[model samples]
Target: MHRFVVIGGGAGGLELATRLGDAFGARRRNPQATVTLIDRNPTHIWKPLLHEVAAGSMDPYTHQLEYAAQAYWHGFEFQQGELTGIDRAAHTVTIAAVDDDTGREMLPSRSIRYDTLIIAIGSTTHFFNVPGADAHAFALDTVAEAERFRRRLIAACTRAESNDDALRAQGALPTHKRHRVQIAIVGGGATGVELSAELRNTAQVLSAYGLHGLDPRDDIGIVLIESGPRLLPALPERVSTETARLLEARAIDVRLGERVTEVAEHAVRTASGRDIPVDLTVWAAGIKAPRVLSTLDGLTVNGLGQLNVRPTLQTELDDDIFALGDCAACVWPTTGRNVPPRAQAAHQQAEFLFRAMRDRLSGRPLRAFEYRDLGSLVSLGHVTAVGNLMGGLIGGTMFIDGLFARIMYMSLYRMHIAALHGIPRMLLDTLAHWLRRRTVPRVKLH
Candidate 1:
């Protein structure tokens, strides 16, 4: 039996393991292969939804997939540990064990050998060595980080509401006579943009609970800073324009062409010599692969820590190894640029690798992976969404907005859930969430 080990149970890795287990694990008495999946977290949350989680608009428990339970149902084995190092010569992976939240010693630091290894460990926030950023700013990279931001946000609001007199005496009050919480998001990409909008909506809901004189539109201030010349610069110009208009309409101060040179306790300094006073600072600007990527033996990574992969998605230095997702640098032939790091691209890469792995086992020629640009979509809270879609089957780009775009944006998430839990479970989960949301407060109160 082939010992197939997949590291990082993320969007791409988890989906691949599930499909492989379902196909190979449910055989007669004997199984064709053994599939093992390892992850730092016991539960999986889709990365794209991290912003919503951070903004307190979504609950992590409701969306998380328990890796152990998922493995039991899908015919795979789940091991929880943090990857520390790798030995290519020994074909082994080193993992460090620790106590779980329940104070149980799960596993010790150990090594696992694999016939085939796949690395899908996603990227992490790169603070660019900005002073005080790592210590002060909130990052929406994981559930813990998101939850931390939400807690601080609620506390900040409560402080403002209860201490209005002191704040007013300090002349912080605007002409509108509303209590305010100033939040600065230091990135204008989809994550920062979506999070600003989500926070605006959720903060409004939070104010209804005796949050005296707090008005989201008038009081809660959201400032988005982008170093680039425009928002969503990677997308179409029209998309950027539409996004800017939507954000502006929501009273979000979108500061274009502004770079943060320094971060302090209560403010951020721009390159153009301006101090933006803010109570909460969020760093969503830049990202690179985990620093561990650079130390992996026999693997070639770009300066960004992305593993350099061939057209077949195999590591340039090691054919027995494969990589995908935000960590892999797979170039696009048409644009001569590396494939954009997106969930859609990751999903496609995993699908391609599924076939390629089968061919490798069968001693046949493996097919190369190609990225298909399916346009982009950005949701501006619950109010609106905008983007374009393009697939070879659909001919040219198709414009979408409003409710139509919202549904499409949601479908992307549903597709991820469906891949893991199947249609019946995914539909049931969706229904349960919708019903629960209608009954509970929109923002997390605790």
Candidate 2:
């Protein structure tokens, strides 16, 4: 039987492995292939929702999908380890030993031979080499980072409230003096914009829960600093304008055309010498593929460290090795540029690869992958969203906003779930979450 090894249990990788296993794993009487998925984390969460996780709007525990459970249900194998190296000539990949929280070894290092290898480890936040940025600012690239920010947010609010109360009791609380928590978000992309909106709601929920004494609207300040002229530069300008208007209407401080030069312990300094005092800083400026991609046995990579791939999604240097998602630099013939690194693009690549792999097994000719632009959506809190829908069916781009747009934004996640577990399970999962929402706080408190 052919052995297929996939590194990374991200959205695209996990979905592809599940499909391959279902079609060719041991469960089938005449199994043709064995699928194995490796990931550093035991569970998987959608990358786009990391902002919600950071803002405490989403409880990650309730939504995380355990890889072991997924593998058991889908006829695939799960390996918990980080990719250390890949040997192209030997047709094997080395996995580093994994250690528990207490520094005890959980799994020893091992090598897995594969007839075909797929790399989809995803991307990480790029800080643009700003001084003190990497050391002080937080990046929402993983669950742990998001959770850390959430905890710090709760602590900051609590500390500010306590300080205000102490000042009041000591008769030192002046009428004009108000304790505040200021958050500085660097970037105006989807992650930054979405996070800013979510943070606003989080502040209100925190106040409603009696977790803080400061006024949510006035005492909690969210400053969004963008080097570009507008927010969501990748989206239509109309969407950007509307998104800016929505955020500004919520009292968020949207600073445009100002590049951050440095990040200090308590503030962010801009090129204009403006210092924005902050209790916390989040870096969502940009993204680059993992550094490991460059060291992968002489695989050709672009300046951003993304593995260069042909239109077929096969690496330029090797046919047995493939890459997808944020890690691959696959060209878009329509735009003459690499496909934008988005969840939609990743989903499309996974679907294409599934069909391509099947064709290869049957000795049939493989088709080139073509990416379709379905437009984009930017979520503004829980009640509103701004974006445009594009397609031949729409005859052009149609702008949408308000509650309808928010629903459409949410449906993207639902569609991802359906891809992995089918429509019935996705529907059941949605119903279960809806019921659970009524019994719990809208935002996570702890």
Candidate 3:
């Protein structure tokens, strides 16, 4: 049997591994391939929902899927380790040792040999070398990071209210004046925009829970700063305009064309010499492939540290090695640019690779990948979303918003679930989550 090793249990990686395992691994009557998935974390959560986690609108425990359970059900081996190095010549990948929370070793370092290797280790936040950014700002790259941000946000709100109460008692603050807790999000992309909207709702929920004394709308200030002239530059201008309008209506301060020069402990300094005071700061400016990609022996990575792959999703110099998702820089012939690093792009690439891998196993030719532009969507809280639907079916680009767009935005996550399990399980999971929501607080108070 051929050995298939996939590094990274991300959205694209997990989906591809599941498909391959179901089709060719031990689950099949006549197994042809032994599939293995390697990831640093023991569980998987959709990257798009990290913002919601940070805002405390979603309970991560309920949504996170255990990698070990997935592998058991799909007939694949799950390895919890970080990719340390790749040896293309030996066809072996080195995994670093894993440690428990108490610093005890859980798994020792080892190398896994593979007949075919797939690299899907996704991107990390790019701070662009801003002064103090790495030390002062938070990035929503993982569940742990998102949880940290949520805790900090809660603490900040509580501390601000406490300070105000003391000042009022001493007659230093007037009764009419409210203490402001400002949060600065350093990006106007989907993550920052969605997070800002979710935080607005979070403030309201926290007030309703009686966790803070300050008024939700009047005291909680969310500022979204973007260096670009408009938000969501990847989308059309109309969508950006509407998203900006919606956010501004919610009292979110949208600052466009202002580049961040420095991040202080309690403030963000802009290129225009504006110093915005903040209680908490989140960096969602951009993303680059993990630094480990650059250390890969003899792999040709692009400027973004992504492996450069051909149209067939194989590395330029190695036929046995393949890459997908945000970590792979694959060209789009239609625009003469690399495919956009979006979940939709990754899903399409994974589907393409599933068929390509089947052909490779059967000694057949692999076809080139053709990416279809499916447009984009940006969520504005739970009630509304803004995006354009593109394709021949829609007869070009049709803009949508409000509740209908919100439903469409949600269906994307459902589709990911259906890809892993079947449509039936996805439906059950949806119903279960909906029922659970009725019992839980709108935002995590603790």
State the displacement of the C-alpha of residue 127, model 3, in Å, after optimal TM-score superposition: 0.7
In the range 1-446, model 2's lDDT, one tens digit per residue, is 88889899898999999999889986778889999999989999999999999999899999999999888888889999999899999999999899999999999999999998999999988888899999999999999999999999999999988888999999897674432899999999999999999999999999999998779999999999999999999999999999999999999999999999999989999999998889999999999998888998979999899999988899998998999999999999998999999999999999999998898788897789999899899899999999999986387999999999999999999999998899999999999999999999999999
Q: Report lDDT (Cα) of residue 347, candidate 1.
A: 92
lDDT sort, best first: 3, 2, 1
Q: lDDT per model, in order? A: 0.87, 0.93, 0.94
Off by over 4 Å in 3: 174-179
TM-score against native, each model? 0.95, 0.98, 0.98
Model 2 worst lDDT run, 10 consecutive residues: 171-180
TM-score winner between 1 and 2, please give it. 2
Candidate 1 Cα deviation (angstroms), residue 262:
0.6
Alpha-carbon RMSD, candidate 3: 1.1
Estimate the TM-score for candidate 1.
Answer: 0.95
lDDT score, candidate 1, position 372? 93
Q: Residue by residue across 357-405, what tens digits does model 1's lDDT show?
A: 7787788988889889988999888757888988783689987789889
